[model samples]
Target: MTSNIGSPAETTQPVGISPYLSKRIFTLQFTSTPRGARLARRLVAVRLDEWGVPYGTEAHETTVLVAAELAANAVRHGHVPGRDFHLSLRVTAELARIEVSDTRAERVPPRPGRLPEPELAEGGRGLLLVERLAERWGWCPRLGAPGKTVWAECALT
Candidate 1:
C-alpha cells in the first residue's frame, strides 16, 4: 500500500494523507542506459523479496528473467538520449504486473512470429522467451506520454 516511484517515500508524505489517496503503485524508474537496465533487473529481485517472493523461487526466477529481457530490450531498442526508462512492479495479492516503458515513440512493437533459434542467430527471441514464461505479454502506447510500455503478468499463487 506504499510506493516510492518518482518521489520521496509515501510514509514521508505529510503523514496525514486520506487513506483513499494513498497509492499502492510502486514504481522504480531508471535511465535507459545498460547499467540502469541491469539495475531494473536487480531491483525486481530485491523488490520481489520485499513483497515476500523470495529470490530463487520458481516465480521469482521467472519474473526476474522476464524483467531482465524486457529491460534489456528497453535499453537496446527503446532508448532516447534524454529520456529514461520506467519500471513498475504492481502487485495485488493475486498477480504481479511488470511493465517497462521507454521513450522511443516512433518505434512500434512487432507481433509474434516463429521464434528464431537462439542457436541460429545473434539476436531475436526476447519476446519469445517472455511469451513462453509469462502468463500473458503485450504492449501499449504510454498513456499521456510519447513512449510505449511493454507489460507482462505473472500470477502469484
Candidate 2:
C-alpha cells in the first residue's frame, strides 16, 4: 500500500469533529540513508505542490526546507541498520506539519526553544534552523513504534 516518491498518494482525513475542517495526509517510509533523505525532501516538495501550496510560495519553501532538515537528522543521528525512517506530511487550512520518525529511540532531539548555543560547534545546527523557520517544532515518542518523531509546523497563509 506504499506509494512511490514520484507520485505520493494522499489520504484526506477529517482532523476534528467539525466536518468542515479536513486535512490531507501523506505518509511514506524511506531507507535510513543519505539518498533516502534526499528523496524524502523531494517528495515533500512534490506533495506540497499537489496539496495547493505550489512550488515557489513561501509556505511551500519553508515547509520543504523543514522537511529536508528533519530528514537529514533522521539519516545522520537516528539511523539504525536495516530500519527505515518514516515521513508524514499533514496539511490543513491554516497549518502544514512535517514529521520525520526514525527507529532510534535513545537519540531524541533536544527540546525546542532551548536550542544549543550556535558558537559551540561548526555543525549540528539543523534543528536550530528548523526552529527559526517553523512556526513551532518539537519531538515525541512514536506511538506503536520503537523510536521518536521530530515534527515541525509551518503556518499556511
Count of clashing residue pairs in every prediction: 0, 0
Best-matching candidate per TM-score: 2
Give the per-residue lDDT of model 2 (tens digit) for 1-157: 1353324223644345442377788888998899999999998898788768899999999999999999999999999998999999888878999989998999887799777788974578899899999999999999998999999999988
TM-score of each: 0.79, 0.87
Q: Would you give me the overall lDDT of model 2?
A: 0.86
C-alpha positional error of residue 128 in candidate 1 after TM-score superposition, expressed in Å: 1.0
TM-score between candidate 1 and the true structure: 0.79
lDDT by residue (tens digit), candidate 1, 114-146: 546568746777888898888888888998888
- TM-score of model 2 (CA atoms): 0.87
What Cα-based lDDT does every candidate model obtain? 0.77, 0.86
